[model samples]
Target chain A: MSDTGLNPDMVSSGGASAAPPLSRIQGVDKVFSNGTVALKNLNLDIGRHEFLSLLGPSGCGKSTALRLLAGLGEPSRGEIRWEGGAPATGSATDKGHRDIGFVFQEPTLMPWATVFGNVYLPLKLSGVSKAESVIPVGEALEMVGLTGFEKAYPRELSGGMKMRVSIARALVTRPKLLLMDEPFAALDEITRFKLNNDLLELWRQQNWTVVFVTHSVFESVYLSNRIVVMAARPGRVYEELEVDAPYPRGEDFRTSADYASHCRRASDALHGAINA
Target chain B: MTMSRPDDDEFIPLPGLTPAQKRERIARLVLPGLILGFAVLAWEIGVTVNEVPHYILPAPSLIAETLIKDWGTLYGSLLVTLQITFSALIVATLGGAGLAILFTQSKWVEISFFPFAVILQVTPVIAIAPLILIYVDTVQVALLICAWIVAFFPILSNTTLGLNSADHNLRNLFELYGATRWQTLLHLRLPAAMPYFLGGLKIAGGLSLIGAIVAEFAAGSAGSGSGLAYRILESGYRLNIPRMFAALFMISITGILIFMSFSLLNHVLLRRWHESAIKREN
Candidate 1:
């Protein structure tokens, strides 16, 4: 299902009516108690099944924006709408079992659980019996190419395998929106490249709305349909770049002229934001 | 890069060939046994040469003879001491784990109660044994309580620290998964605490033995039903030095047994995945 030789907006055309926006943020602002303004009057629309990346420098509050959307933290001001309506008002803690999934920068696999047990956790929390959870857990493991590692403990797995388990855990719940916070930041370059390809494949198959947070310009350009660049020290949107690269873009695309130009543009934008 | 063959993972190497391999491997036994045998030989020789009084450092042979001759009385007292130690150990495990869970749940409870736990740990069991005897009615129960007090804190402190020491990232993952507080405690926190709890248990195992013996000393209960502590005292008073040595030997053996049992348990639970369990060849 590669969107080869296609405009960025082409992916949004046919499903525009059927798959409504999964999230809408309108003029959201976040200020900390220490007199630090983290986000300033940000407005964005996240469409269903679109892999949107928030790219910026280290303290640009990309993580904060993701946190706000995940309902882990409240926006200091303005509205966040989910599924065409304003997000329910209250503390994020009050959201009582939301169906959102999050993968952190670190693998964050539970040390005490086996690979299978970690993937099965959300279902177990939802009161699914062990017998019923087996099929879904196996399928998730299979998706991540960790079929035989079910009984292996987290400590027994390599760093990449651990992250794969973490990904499997997030995917097992079948969430509509998947939020990732620099999940591959700790992996080696080669592993990160492979995982990025696998992630895009999973995105194509599952069609979940994704909001990825990253500090790397190249990663954002390669993976996102649109990149929302933010500036640091009272973060606000500096610019939004739509990546016109076709879907299922492979290693060869990384060597192409288009990829280099996109990376250069993103890099210059980031540099300008930082210098300013 | 090619991965190592899966069969290589299952390989267990033997050091050498022939009975000598078995002898060399089991030769660890020889050193300790030789030392013990030499010590016994020296004792018997000293008794013969110096014509030392039987009331003082009796020969190992004499001690063994006394142990065998008085097997009924010594056996009965051994049973009593074992009962007290095991009972106290059970109480400590339950009470320590329960208090640890409580401390993990409430910050205020931890702050208020943790110092008291420290105080209990540092205070000498000998100093409190008399007071505990005064308050508690039965000798057995008083001894058990004192032993529990001495043994309980390490497990409590270690397990509580372990529970709080869970990986911060993992805790966040649990929160993202919408796990309830109790579910997190049962599934994540408690299992993380196991190794620490086992560490504490190893320490507590020896302490329980010491506590039982010390409590018995403070209680000053003697005669047929008294524990091994009384046997040591009785033999000492009667100048049956060999029997006293035998009682001391039994106590040391009990301590080693406790250590071995806990080490075995630690191996059985964590050996499959933990580094501590994997034996390295040097």
Candidate 2:
């Protein structure tokens, strides 16, 4: 893998290590100037190829956590470390030097750009020559099942197609860590289910770490290897659940008895957090 | 509940055409065309029946005859008016886009300069035309400057709004990709601003013609070269009403020409990309 330089296996496995932790959040606190606490004393360790989700209700700061990780906002106190180092400072270019992909609740595809052009954006920013970028862009578009939509502008696409374009855009960079903030919340149920399954397939194939933020308990249960349930009003983690389901989880798994068990547990945890 | 088979596989054809659709298509053409034809007929009849004299109100046929007779002179003046309008439009587009970029970059500059732009938009160009003629030294330069001032503000205002109106979610998506400010402006803001800028261009196109005529009126009276406005003024003073009507008809035709040119440009630029450009097939 091109990312072997930052191999997570080297750090934890007692092997000769070239690099360190892929991402580390320690003692992070976020308080606005207006004195509203968003995240409190947060600590998280995300290794390469892990699928972790921050599951919470509205105002629980799941999106805020994602923003902090993306370096869109700074932690009020403490630090976010990428590759076992402090967040980069100075110019926005310098800040968060690590390659990070983000998808918002909305598709956020550029209305002016065709699907291919939108996918080509990060590559263009990295100064990848157009010829060099074509294959990777094509592969990413194919991965998202948007193969023939290369020339279709965002306005011409339906909501699902737009979101697929957004996903393709994020994947074009092949970033080590993908941060998605409630990306499927706006989708209809069937589209949401299809996207969820497609996303997991992509995750398994790429083996990239994903930090997904979502308000849906079923979503977090379905897609995450681990779910971190957050409480509202000063957003703190209320519970952590490790989903023991095997890899390459299929649509069949969604209807299995185990899926219901996980959902029930998550719902209980959420209720407990709200009450507490 | 069983998951409804994804509508993804369904290809719903466009709705069937009905009597209503036919009626709508016919009405769209007939309503505007009929109203125009009726108005022209009334004007022709009123002038002939009331014996309003050709000088007072030349019939449409006489106007057409005058147009045919004076086609060469009128055509020359029309080209001059077009030159002023198009030149002013180009200058306004470049100037407006440049200032909008600057304003987007700095809040202080926007706050300071925006009010001055508003003042220019509201202030009468006729009031300033003589002053511009006196200071500009050349008649063409004076006319260009006057038209530019009149046409510049809409583009600036519309473009700035469009640039700033990028969706917050899209802005975040760009930031997440670590796009530089310049990259964001070029790839995101500028493309997003196209519709608004083009809208402003349409409005400015008409204003440019009006401004050129107004400026020429003030300039010709101040002893500048003879433009269409001067011909109209001179013909009216000499009680040459047919010639004055002819000049008025030429000016209206000039306005229509300016409008058609811009409408064409809008269609060409936006046809494949925008709903506003799409003509209904039905």
Candidate 3:
């Protein structure tokens, strides 16, 4: 039930060469129907158990890339394959979908549903009975520190609490892969920083691969072991920088000189991406 | 830094109204009652002062006396109207909701039949009542049909709008999870459309009574087996003006009661989660 033991020392050593790719976007070209080239020749590899951040500006197709990875979208002209074969995507029963836990830019909780119902959704969709899913849903809620708030509606929760419910819903299925798209772009600085720490702690504890898409250089550098800076027009990877900082990253790391330097580098790459 | 624990300062009581809420509740009932009381008192005084003729406009006291004296006959008519109103309302709700669900299933069906529904809605029930009366075996069935036609459109349109108004992000989430059409409609669409459905039901409740009355009026002079509309007509012909006023009073009371019942249903269903139902300090 735990993925923590699968790849414990997954800290990247400034190289994508050591670990086998959990998935690959091989020469992916996504041309939207309206003649927008959202992504072109976007070749990237997802390192197993790696904390990867897709850093880009608004038009950089970072979210598009994450969507493709989550099997919520498809490349117009290239292959997205899993480790052994093509992404085994079908319905909720598919291997590709079951392996992923997606956190959207907005906390897309059902307004009428309770926290428990929202967290129980993925399992319920996969035909797991409510009775069978009770424990996992409870554990997921507890993991997000929302254990007592299970019966609360989304409207009752503040923005951050709603996001936590979204996270709990994502985590309930115990997915191997977690994909997020600007999940914290809407929060205030204090709440964002707090969530950043809580998220990193959860990531460290769970040991699942995370593909976080963000516009914030500071956020990418703080969370990702390797940040893939992307360019805008015909969105493509401009460069990749490994943070090389050790795990158990905390508030101390947030204020450290190395963290600021990494943020500077990531921001510079992002600006170059926006211009190019 | 803070989570919205149930024990937060929001101070929602476990199962009953809080003190402030109870006071607001009292104000809700008392304010409406005060307005009605003031208006009725003014009417009674105004009539007594002007020495208004009983036939033109009966005083409140006179109407009340007539109401008690004629209770046996008027109550029967009121029951008849209530039965038709409720039966029509139920049919409209079921038919409208069922059709809306079908529309969600396929755009073609909606495209094919929506215009016809619009036609039914736009055409006045009085204009259609004659045709309905000719086709149906009984006047009651014709009255019910007329009422259903008037009440059906709001529920259909509101429910359809609500279903279509589902958040794009949530729809994408459902698609991402591979929810089937049935599951999505049943779980997501139905709950999303509830507030809209209830809003429409409130409107339809009043409109159904109006439709029944109009249909009865159109039935005119001959259709006299049951209903307040007929009593009004019969009293008018007999020149029993007080009795006519009594029948009208019962009709008004019934309409208000129907409106209140459905409004209460809406409040109860949406109180916990809906923005409209949530009580704010302001």
Candidate 4:
């Protein structure tokens, strides 16, 4: 019932207009039709402008929680309501007016489409014409270091480059919420680290509420200002550890004693989570 | 900003090719042509030396002579055969791809009609041609129907497989973006199926030609308006073996040309992205 890591000052420090309670996920129970209880009695509030990571072992239902928030799958039982009673627009968009950006585990770019076309997909779905979408897509591509590769097919890209294109596509729409599921787990360590820094840069600049799911403690500590360690066997929230490491964490921070202590704390929490 | 065409990791270029690479490339083409020329020369000489009768096995020279002598008649017949072949292929492609899309749209439609498509595929075109000949008023229409039946199944099955093979994650992403059914079908499934449908089209090209010829053979129509198939039958009945060889040559060349054109189309469409189409160095 108690949140373990709370940095009272950090949320409002970065000029992040991200107010807390971006959404309240209360008592969510997700049971698949074949009867796998992926999540049980989960309650959490996603903070605004926060880079939050759901850290857990495999099968901890971190992805399941992300999926529910993406409006992809409904929980078998529970309620998820936005902080401001949904956006002010009554435009009657197809997806119940919840604007979200989602990144999957795979790069998942359209192989047949060029990078420009792939990034243009979300805008296109919202009925924006190709000519009209050029600026947004281009800006998004530039943000992810994929500006020159707009015409390159997915096959032309290395794994890291493809993932960059994917991230660009997600950010193109400028959604208020971004949900990512283990996006860099497949990349080599160096690429993952580089991407981590770039992603943090983007998060800082954009101030979008991020709910990232990952199995790495080091990653959660490095990127996230808040971490939710979840447990398996009917996956549920185990602890909320606030990574009080100040903003602009860089390579210097990576080798610092503070980073080591944070890693140690997350690892201990994870160890307890797996055992429990 | 300077950019190059996307580099292929699999491709490794050898430093600089001297005369050897040129020679190898030329040999690949010239060797086959030389062998074919040698074979034809041998056959011509063998026939002249052995004094073989024209009906028994006409020399290559005689076939060439007959082809030149009957140029106007043979050319018109070739055109007729080609017209039927192309018409049947177009019909098959449009019908098969359209039905495959409908099948993807509905499980009940696919389940109900798929076995019937299988039945149409397995039953011989020759066996069906006679019945079609009776039922269809025009001989051309009957032959067209026969050709289409044989060519239809490959495109249907291949496109269906392709439509189903869209990346699971990509489909999920599309769903996440709230792409409507029509949007998903148009943007995802159909494009994914393009390579498969093109592959099926290559196979259907050859089959369509064979179907046209076979159906025409089954019909056995002769004289002024007859196709190359009728020319073959007429030559056989009249014991004009040289003319028969000429007509047979035309059919063989036509089939090869059809296959090559489709292969070219597949290469053009897919070489940029598809793994099967892209050239690998390793």
Alpha-carbon deviation at B135 in model 2, angstroms = 2.7
Q: Cα miss at B261, model 3 (Å)?
A: 1.3
Worst ten in a row by lDDT for model 2 chain B:
B1-10
Candidate number with greatest DockQ: 3
> TM-score of every model?
0.86, 0.88, 0.92, 0.90
- Candidate 3: RMSD to truth: 5.2
Candidate achieving higher lDDT, 1 or 4: 4
Q: Which ten residues in a row have the lowest lDDT in candidate 1 chain B?
A: B1-10
In model 4, which regions exceed 4 Å deviation?
Answer: A1-20, A86-98, B1-28, B221-225
| Tens digit of per-residue lDDT, candidate 3, span B1-282 | 222232212323324568988898899989999999999999999999999999898898998999999999999998899898999999999998889888877999999999999999999999999899889989899999999999999999988888887877777777777777877887788899999999989999999999989998888866755799999999998888989999988888888898989989998888878888875664
Q: Cα lDDT of all candidates, in order?
A: 0.79, 0.78, 0.82, 0.84
Which portions of model 1 show Cα errors greater than 4 Å? A1-20, A27-41, A84-98, B1-51, B221-225, B278-282
Evaluate residue A75 in candidate 1 and report its C-alpha lDDT on the 0 to 100 scale.
Answer: 89
Model 2 agreement with the true structure over B54-111: per-residue lDDT tens digits: 8777898888888788878777776787788789988998999899989999999999
Number of the top-ranking candidate, with lDDT as the measure: 4
Among incorrect, acceptable, medium and high, the docking class of model 4 is acceptable
Of models 1 and 2, which has the larger lDDT? 1
- In the range A1-276, model 2's lDDT, one tens digit per residue, is 111122211212211224455777777789988999998877666766778888877888788889999888789987877774543321432312336788888888776677788898877765567788788888878887877667877766678777888888887777677899999888889888888888887888777889999889899989987777778787777777767788778778899999999899888887776775
